[model samples]
Target chain A: MKTVWTQKGFLIPAGALLIAILLPIFASEYALHIAVLVLLYAYLSTAWNVLGGYAGQHSLGHSLFLGIGAYTSTFLFTKIGLTPWVGMWIGALLAGLVGWFVGYLCFRYGLKGPYFALVTIAIAEAMVSLTNNINFIGGAMGLEVKWLGNSPLLMQFESKAGYYYIALVMLVIALWLVYWLSRQRFGYHLIAVRENEDAAEALGVDTLRVKIQASILSAFLTALGGTFFAQYFTYINPRNVFGEGPSIQILLFAIVGGLGTVWGPAVGALVLVPIAELARGWLGGSFAGAHLLLYGTVMVLVMLFMPKGIIGLYESIRQRLKRGSSAPEEERTPA
Target chain B: MSMLTVSNLSRYFGGLAAVVDMSFTVEKGEIVGLIGPNGAGKTTVFNMLSGFIPPTSGEIIYQGRRMNGLKPHQICELGVTRTFQVVQPFPDMTVLENTMIGAYVRHPNTTDAKRKALETLERVDLDAKADKLGRDLTLLELKRLEIGKALASEPDLLLLDEAAAGLKDTEIEDILTLIRQLNREGMTLLIVEHLMKVIMNLSHRIIVLDFGKMIAEGTPQEISQHPAVLEAYLGKDE
Candidate 1:
């Protein structure tokens, strides 16, 4: 608990945010677009980290909520002319309920580790199939938001800066939420459950309730990203929104950045997305999927060399540097 | 009339009975020792009392409330907490953070729980290593942390499973002193230990189990000479 004003650590984020706000003035539209994509992934991945990283419940099917958010808001906007700003909240609520139901079914029966991951993937796939057969919400073809040039009220923007700012604001809020939780009892309990469920239970932590709450929160926030995705792209098919690709992309950023840390996912997105986008831009004509190959290779290298992710690596390096500055405590021999 | 009362408790794994028709009552503020050889179901009984598993047929009444069917956390919330025979530390967390998890049961606020955990860590003589990660601790420190974690919850009754299982004689003596100090401070303890030195030195009353059945129950002195207890340990001469 040091207040934000007192802590020197707050400068990193503050500085980063300041840089992000001013970047639009000098940066090209392409860079801004990549920045928006980075922010969106960072937001979604941070939401994923609440359950996957902090609670040690790796969910690979978060696209279920993503699809829910995209479809809900899109359907409302397309069919009934409801504004997406209001519709996004409804999508978030629906995603939260589904999150609760999914969490209840999996955690109530003690499904954990790989089994829980499989169940989530299964559920998301089932949603994909269900959405495909349904006609009311455009089925497999998907819904498209009606184009309205420079319409702020409808969340459609003429320039990339509007979406960039929205994405930036969303990411900041999500990061702040995670930072706040990290200092709270819920965050501690989630880590406790992650470390050892039986030990946590013995310590009087309600593991099930903590985990379920994490699921609901993670799903709700991820659905918000889904709505943002729909608004930004103006088109979201079930395959793109609720498919395995989006789900994998979300968790990858969390994993690569740092599983449990507040800024890890954002850092992960910050580093990886630009590289992917740039590689595709530079090498697309010669090798269509070469950038993906590079991305996958980089991911493999990170997992092999930095399994705890970039944050863990940074922490260990800092610890070593600190130790180097002072005489370290003598290691006690085992009794 | 008792702090904890168990009646006709039994747990059968498939056709094999781990513990059967066992009953005991622990008075408040008393240090009770449960002793048995390996697979004698000492740990099984501890597991039942702490709500790690349910008994097949029986009742566990603690302070006038039935404990069966309740989750382990609920059991801990009701002023009962247990430590494992194998130490469990959150490896990624600092020692202070690990202890804080238990303090959080009573102190919901982070600052308040941290203060409480620090005090508990001091009580366990682990204050110096508060900043160390749980994974870096020595075995003796891990054991102390296990007890410190349970103590942080401020339990009315603490269940310690083999708290001194893998300690040197001097280390055992050190832990015995800690246990003695805890009892003197009016904390009730139910200990399951294979080491006679620990059980005899600490328990106010000792219960001996053989084949999951209570073979002897008495003060340490009386239980030492009890024939069934001797038979359970040394096996009938000739």
Candidate 2:
């Protein structure tokens, strides 16, 4: 009596979404806002997973795309009187182009391993420096959208529910993309390159082209999230967009969830984001930076105790249970 | 007609001449065995030929095209492929996927690549382990997977570096039979092996190297009784 829904294994996600939608009804307004932030990070983490997880390219500079996305949309709306909805695609395209260029330079020069990670960090830092000196979009002071009216057309919402729904849609899209990528031929090539470049090349895979494509796709999706974040918050700053904290948070979600698995980052965000908000709410102003300290400590603990990640730990336990149940039954009727 | 021609190929590491003044021609659709003692620069010769390492001074003409300074992938695209002495299948990939990547060169489409990969796996009799990961395979399976990968590339010239090393006698026989079958199917093969019996059974002609110099070149039967070949292998103990 296997059900179609259960057979597909989509029941978990379906159930989870149902719970998420129903939670805002019983929860406080503050809790809803926290949930929105969690969904946003989860979406971004999943996007990063395309390059960092599937491709095995550790990029510490993903915040560069986020910053570019936020800046592009906000700049377009404030300068040309365009709505953010129209600006989103523009931002995504720009981010993807920039990502391709950066990836090309890194891959062409054979900058790999930790050196590649360092290059990403350098690019992010350089972007921050460049933005600081460039006064085109309010420079170091940051940009704020001053609106006469809170209009849905402007992508400015009066309630947190609108942001929640949007973030939910993004998360769903990111998860689907990750799922599709994991089963695709390009996805297999990325994994092969990740596992062993020499072996992949010997087998006729063009490693550089595959990696660059991964990077471009990751950047485009990440930038879309950035546009949404700017429109939802109605404020954008270089520090907030391209900051080290945002970079760490995205990586932490992916790493804490499961580095290479599709659902790992989403699971990580669901578990960690609310805890972070709760810690901040409980600690208050006197305990400033305590949430960060706690987050860092938990990340370190997760890495040390469960190196394969929370999802990996869950898989190991599941396998053990399966073996235990099946083995005992087989022993009872030994040949 | 020669498919591959090497002339005045030389490589030096500081003061040591690894491969010096070497020249050879591998005729189309022929098996040429390169036999040499340890450190006689046999692997280095293969490396230079396959574009893994550049020769300090040399010319390599493959399929009547200059192949002196091309990358390994480019050389592969030009219908030349080689297997490493150390088996290098992507350990995380299944045996079928490992071969599929090789087949991808000719058939970039997924369906076509998988179909060709299946055919190559069947030829090597590794179709049963198609779903098994490379890391989980036995030593013989790994070696077979390596050959399957090279075969997947659809190469005109296949360079096999010590394909029979570290194998049991029966395993070696299986590989020899597969090589003979491939040769009969019109594939050109250049094999490097230390095993006398396998080389004698497979090679149409043998070239022996000692101290980075060609000591003998003849048919397997002729080389077997050559005093220089015997002296090179046994150090004149006879």
Candidate 1: which pairs clash? Answer: none
Model 1, range B162-231, lDDT digits (tens) per residue?
9999999988988899899888898999999989988998999998888988888999999999999888
Cα RMSD to native, each candidate?
Answer: 2.0, 3.2
Q: What is candidate 2's lDDT per residue for B143-195, written digit by digit as tens?
A: 99999998998998999998988999999989999999889889999999988
- Per-model fnat list: 0.91, 0.41
Give the candidate number with the greatest lDDT.
1
Q: Measured against the native two-chain assembly using Cα atoms, what DockQ does each of the candidate structures obtain, in the order listed?
A: 0.92, 0.49
Q: Indicate which candidate wins on TM-score.
A: 1
DockQ of 1: 0.92
